[model samples]
Target: MKAKLGPAKGKVSDLAQQHGDKIQHGLDRAAKAVDEKTKGKYSDRIQSGTGKAKDAMERLAHQEGTGPGPGAGPDAGGGTPNGPRPPVS
Candidate 1:
């Protein structure tokens, strides 16, 4: 059966906006695995592709066509997630 793009797109956009950082993290992890499996043969390509994906996610999350809501990203002035560490020694 043919799927409707309208509802799907809206859902995806909402997800992207809500969990953009988490989504980007998963993409980075997948890219790392692929690069490792390829023994660095596709390192450059993988990095480029992962970067593009993160950029697209960011755009979706920060689009704010209707105005600002929650999830203002890192620049919200609250600092990074989980607070800071002990300077990593």
Candidate 2:
């Protein structure tokens, strides 16, 4: 899901969009780990924490400009397109 943000300078929306999914994935894994460690004793707490983590990550990503993008990926001119290109002569 896309997180809304107010107009601000130095925002990194592209990065957020690209990494948000990865961050959420990691959080999910962490939550699962916690649940496993607890032997499913605190399923509710684990789930709640997971949700909070996901929400926080999304908010932070959006605030930092790493949430979803308009197109499939980040927009051009956002940063180094793809990867480092050949050095200009």
Candidate 3:
């Protein structure tokens, strides 16, 4: 059985979709602040992490399920109780 998303997850997914641009702006500002505080010492790493975060947010906002991210979809992962899940083996 597919695991149904809880109310909180549903709300988060809706918020993510609605405020994705604002969220991305916040991420950029945070990354800039961190880079400034480090005086460019960790600029590369900070930028990389920021890019990844933005991509993740975009994906979550676009996910076609009740929640965010990859495993939040009904067909994505095993969340059923006492159900047999396929092992990689």
Candidate order by decreasing TM-score: 3, 1, 2
Q: Give the Cα error of residue 40 in candidate 3, in Å.
A: 0.3
Q: TM-score: which is higher, 2 or 3? A: 3
Each model's backbone clash number = 0, 7, 0
What TM-score, to 2 decimals, does candidate 3 have?
0.65
Write the residue-wise lDDT of candidate 3 on 20-70 in tens digits.
989988888888888878888987788778777766676666654554465
TM-score of every prediction relative to native: 0.60, 0.52, 0.65
Question: Residue 20 in candidate 2 has what lDDT?
Answer: 81
Off by over 4 Å in 2: 1-14, 64-89
Question: What is the per-residue lDDT of model 2 for residues 1-89, given as tens digits with 9 covering 90 to 100?
Answer: 23343333225544556688787677778877878888889878777777666555555554443434556464422332233222111
C-alpha lDDT score of every prediction, in listed order: 0.64, 0.56, 0.65
Q: Which window of ten consecutive residues has the lowest lDDT sum in model 3? A: 80-89
Where is the poorest 10-residue window by lDDT in model 1?
80-89
What's model 2's overall lDDT?
0.56
Candidate that would win on TM-score = 3
The collision pairs in model 1 are none
